[model samples]
Target: MYTQTEIIKDTTINGSEGELVINVGPQHPATHGVLHLVITLNGETIKKIEPHLGYIHRSIEKMCESLTYRQFIYVTSRMDYLSSHINNEACALCVEKGLQIEVPARAKVIRVLMGELTRIASHELWLGAMAMDLGAFTPFFYTFREREMINEIMEDTCGARLTMNYMVAGGVAMDLHPDFQRKVKLFVTQFKKRVPEFDDLITNNIIFQNRMKGVGVLSGEDAISYGCTGPVARGSGVSSDIRKLYPYDGYDAVAFDEVLETAGDSYARYLVRLREMHQSIRIIEQLIDAIPEGDFQAKTKAVLKLPKGEFYTRVETARGELGVYIVSEGGTTPYRIKFRSPGFSNLSALHHMAKGSKIGDLMATMGTLDLVIPDIDR
Candidate 1:
């Protein structure tokens, strides 16, 4: 086992010379994005893994500093496109906090609904990609079939499938579609039936279990130390769900479990995300029928400006905690902006988790981490 210190140093054993060095990707499909991993291997076992990033660096924080507050929130969508809704929500919440704007009840519930839907969609993609990483090609098709239902729902309401940019300072950009409820309810019913098929296809397969069970264990302490979040930290039994810790946008009213697993391995993380999709369904069901009738957006000034101060807001994205911090000089533009994206922190743990593991298991571990490289580069 490699300690955190040794892993950080990435020291090579002196006696073991002529070890193979390989670059996994800057364009590899298994990377999920333009992420390059330099792997040092001793035969089939991995000795070190170093991540080379910045292929898709957008400098989003600096760009947000120049744009007006309203324009800045949309930029975050490109960072974690999978959790774009939650990312937009986080930025909006921070801007609202600085301006001291109280969102309407209807908009709050709507935001929560959209946020949960984004979570399910992200997990669906992750489920498919993880299975494919393990060489189960059929599960990818199975998972994407269910995920497209979510894309359809988003397209009907948010007007965009990937980066909706539907959130604003006071609330969402528009009201839900006339058929939103009916469509979502139907999707919920259909997805519930198909969720089980994932287990039969990949989760319970003997080959998958062997590949995942004991590989790439991330202990609870190390998870926290490295600032891992979302399913990655939860799989290690770290109780850090931002929704439960700091409820916002009607999350306090909804009842849902913070999914947890104690094993701290790749399989544990995999199970956490799968169970979380059901919990997201649970959150949606609780709020769907009870959506209050009122304006979807609260009234705000045409030109919004924040008070001269610092403000921060956090939202639980599909990957994990997304924190938006803004320093305002009482202007339409932010003095400075910083996004604490989950992918960057989670990616930091790759070397620690991959060390001492076989080269083949590298894909399994990276799949469970579910990294989005743009989020890191930003």
Candidate 2:
């Protein structure tokens, strides 16, 4: 619900400003998902923007309250399946905290590696989608060509491309594939070689530059108050990557730069994600050979139960911070669960960013938002 402020109504003597309420969509391709924005416009200037959500909310929190600790990990995979490893990590961390289980050193290293891979994959898909939203078609295919390698590696180990229930409470569900190291090395080599081509193809392209260069400017103050995270926050000159602030798994040992941009505009967001991918590759190469041999799954009783308490975990998803809040009642299931999704906070900035832009710029502006509706709705 919007704030309860009295309206300064101006019904009579309206200017030559043609005002009308326009519905952007529950189906607009540029919305990034089933997001419907009701905007009041006077000519090309936006007067007001209201977002109507819940088109995709399946009450995932309620469902988690019925599933056991071991079962809830798979449910979180649906929130941001592009970064399923991170989603699983959050669930596992919460359960681990509750159970006080000591995961082996091997599990932590593998989790960090997979988490970094998920981050790269999520950013890759976002890059393609954002480019396509701006009417650039060729770069999407180019980005996907590189991203397909990550999906193949995931499929071989987890048995599914997306929404893999790969992480358990104390350790991973399965051991790393026999060729995991070799395949990741190949992807690292391929990604490093292809990144420069992407810059030449889209990032440095004149048409894309014209569309994104100075549009949708969000100031650093606005970004902080809006609770933005990931590249969205980093683009606005904010350092809020959870991996850096709160290191989990093997993040503390790895050496990588946190990508930052001070422009606070659509182009800034694009540049931030593009550079972050490079850092992800750097971390992957550092840890590829360091994956130690040990038990993948920690020993736990058949029917797992968590202590009665509140468990909270904040993980940096591809888009931003995905916070999972779970309340247990000394049973197999949770009493209540709340997910603070990144897209919701990031999309809220859309109204402020697109205030005076042209209709075409609206697509360019929203593309930078990089929303996945299920994450928002869930």
Candidate 3:
């Protein structure tokens, strides 16, 4: 229950000879966004981690109040750009719930396909960035080589690589490209081969294991207490995958394991994402050939209106669960909008995890959390 000022007062280390105060970023390259971490250090051991955020805040929730439901979905893309497709999907699902729109079967399969691809793309980038954060740079190049193939697929199908506004209220903005299936199969084949190489290059390296394996451990109870989700919760043995729990966008039809690890350390989180990529590939393999030949989008009015009520929907994003809540007064725009984004909740555990660890260990902890700061600030 500490106020912002009180929290800062407690974390600030005055210029004492044995202690130091350092800013990790509002612009440090290792950080994913404009996240500013004020680290209080007694030599190398971390006394505290106080994050100063909001550098990229756009008041997206309030902005959603002004924009129509269909238009608001794209704004979420700018929040967690790596998981943009999933973000948009959450908002669209919420809007569709309010409208009681029954999405076409073809649209459902296509949405799931895009969701899995987005998950893999996000994890590939996370693996690269996480390795780089631990001082191994070569994996970044190798990981991005595979990630770029997914981006090519996204560009060909969605007309944009990042922040793709593909999801609509009833279904998708457009149908899948004719080449989508062929390219995804090719990428999955190559990616499956490259994953073992990642294990060889970084995952099994003694130095990498030492940096990750017992550092910044978060237990299952603490993970749930902190409302952690996605790999962060799964790493700690908390079963919190929304796709598995809620089964939206034909997720129930596809078979894939909810990747989990009980070690609850940086390496466990790393392993969760790695295995989740394989699961995503398995999901695509199941549905890519079976996409129903039907309308890609459901019939909807040009200017949509929602009945007076509250609607909420949750979806599994690359980072975690993204919940979109909307309040409507029988209008084209939402009366109030709120997004329960995973990054903000996950960031709350940073101080808890990073304290008593080395400054170097902080990188492993934060990297495993896989934070995207705009999601927090928004």
Candidate 4:
């Protein structure tokens, strides 16, 4: 294991033959976070790509072991901050499973609604950032315009925009805001009209298509082997949507198609996310008007203690499947905890996808992966 200083020195050294060793991040914009990539390039052709992580490692799983069930869920929000709500939901669901807590029906619906909204918001931001990564800056502003509305809605109900720790073991922290329905409905209406503009601005552009269509192709077999999930796997025609295969929190009650594309390339991944936003909107429409008029939270004791056993729960976050596993010793705090974060798995395939592709094509491939560095580091 090389130290950080040694790794930097290694990048400056010339590889065997004419291969050049170059570093892409650890402090670079295209990474979107503190991710370091050591790429071996032979005349602008990528020979290999190695990711150096731990730049932002927070030891979240280790931290969760020391926290009570209720306290640990919030720590996950900092993992995939873009899908913070979904991350919190995963932890809460795992705790509920351990205690065999019966979440209220209204709470189930609310969880699903917030989850889908988080998915859309996450994708909207990814779309803009990915576009900007490919040198199209206008779409960044266009996409953020809609994402701001979602953030405002999140702030109104959850009292925080980025890391909303609204999800609890049995239900949400509070009831929906009085204007939640109105604001969400209005945002939906506006978003539907603006999606077309996205296509006109970037999606349908010939140059953009050329850059994405054949770049960073990963076969379905390879994607599955790398443990890819969510858009990354679905883009390769893999049926890996956890919401569809393993429904939880009223997902089985909702009607939404699992978006898939067979190309297994950057463009395919892009299309999956774009179409998925519409599916998220579909799910929201179905449950928005039908929110049950009942207790928002289930009755539970003041303190939560799980039986001596192991428990696990999985949820489909915007990036992919997030699994929370906990081992309890009949105690308030977890004996041990582990997280199966999607970004880590998806990143494992970077070398396979980038090899033999042009160095410039790296952005399109990595951008389409939509990696969140903290998620990987955590």
How much is 309 displaced in model 4, in angstroms? 1.0
State the lDDT at 95 in candidate 2.
85
What residue runs in model 4 are displaced by over 4 Å at the alpha carbon?
1-14
Per-residue lDDT of candidate 1, residues 1-378 (tens digit)? 234455335545433566777778887989998898878888888888888888899899889989998899889999999999999999999988988889999999999999999999999999888888888788889888888988999999989999999899899899999999998899899989888898888778889999999999999999999999999999999998999999999788889999999999999999999999999999999988999999888889988899999998988899998888899999889999999999999999999999998898999999999998888999
What's the lDDT of the predicted structure labeled candidate 2?
Answer: 0.85
lDDT of 3 at 220: 97
Point out where model 2 deviates above 4 Å.
Answer: 1-17
Candidate RMSDs in Å, in order, are: 4.0, 3.5, 2.7, 1.6
Q: List the residue pairs that clash in candidate 1.
A: none
Residues 114-170 of candidate 4 have per-residue lDDT tens digits of: 998999999999999999999989999999999999999999999999999999988
lDDT of 3 at 307: 97
lDDT of 3 at 238: 95
lDDT of 2 by residue, 9-46 (tens): 22123324477566787888888678888776777777
Candidates ranked, most accurate by lDDT first: 4, 1, 3, 2
In model 4, the clashing pairs are none
Candidate with the greatest TM-score versus the true structure:
4
lDDT of 1 at 189: 96
